[model samples]
Target: MVGFNGKSNSAKQIIHRMRRGPTLPDGGVNFECHCVSHLVASPCGYEFREAIKCQKAASEGELEEGACADELMNFMRCAIRTECFRSW
Candidate 1:
């Protein structure tokens, strides 16, 4: 996503940084160095990682199947909103 400065940051950098350390309450790791502008434009990457965790748990019978759909929908909705509203 493009930062407030209008420079694009690599999705790979964002995703990799998010996955590099311990998980947060949202189930994805947070990085201190991430651009706040990027985070504001796209919150779904974190949510999507969380939903993937939920889906995996459901698939393993650790969580109810019904719960997975809701989380998945949340991920999708956030993704669409982020893409649609992105500054560039």
Candidate 2:
């Protein structure tokens, strides 16, 4: 996502930084960074990574669309959770 100065940062970096924040009483964590989008995106980072792996497998012909169904759903769910349509 774009930083305050309009520079782009990796999803992994954003997610990691956000996850470093303190855990709340409600079993949630608060982020320390100023990237508001990351706050929402962090929770879905694992799913995003899984989706990437699935895509890579598909691109290499090691996986088919049908095989990627679960990964695709997970990716979509994470995207929805983060409200980050461009989560990748």
Candidate 3:
């Protein structure tokens, strides 16, 4: 009686909720390059995501190359600027 009993929440409603954007809070939209958790919020997020996908594809032989080098460099730069990362 406390949870979905199939009456209050229909299957369609559940599916719609699941179809929403990234699982991360704030709609997963990071607006800065703070380098939190090794990922830049803005452009780096997209680049890093693609790089990871490419790496996976390479490991699986689905691609002739591995992760993106350009994005990796950008990530390094961002990491250096981050205060907690200790760029020294």
lDDT of each: 0.60, 0.60, 0.50
Give lDDT tens digits, candidate 1, residues 1-88: 9866788879996687565544455664343424333443356757666676666456555455376777778877887876745566
Of models 1 and 3, which has the larger TM-score? Answer: 1
Per-residue lDDT of candidate 2, residues 1-88 (tens digit): 8977798989997787556634434534333334433433566766755665565546545554376778779878877876765535
Candidate 1: list runs displaced more than 4 Å: 1-42, 60-65, 84-88
Instruction: Count backbone clashes in candidate 3.
Output: 0
| Candidate 1 clash pair list | none
Stretches off by above 4 angstroms in model 3 are 1-47, 59-67
Worst 10 residues of 1 by lDDT: 32-41
Least accurate stretch of 10 residues (summed lDDT) in model 2? 28-37
**Model with the higher lDDT, candidate 2 or 3:** 2
lDDT score for residue 36 of model 3: 37
lDDT of 1 at 28: 45
List the pairs of residues colliding in candidate 3. none
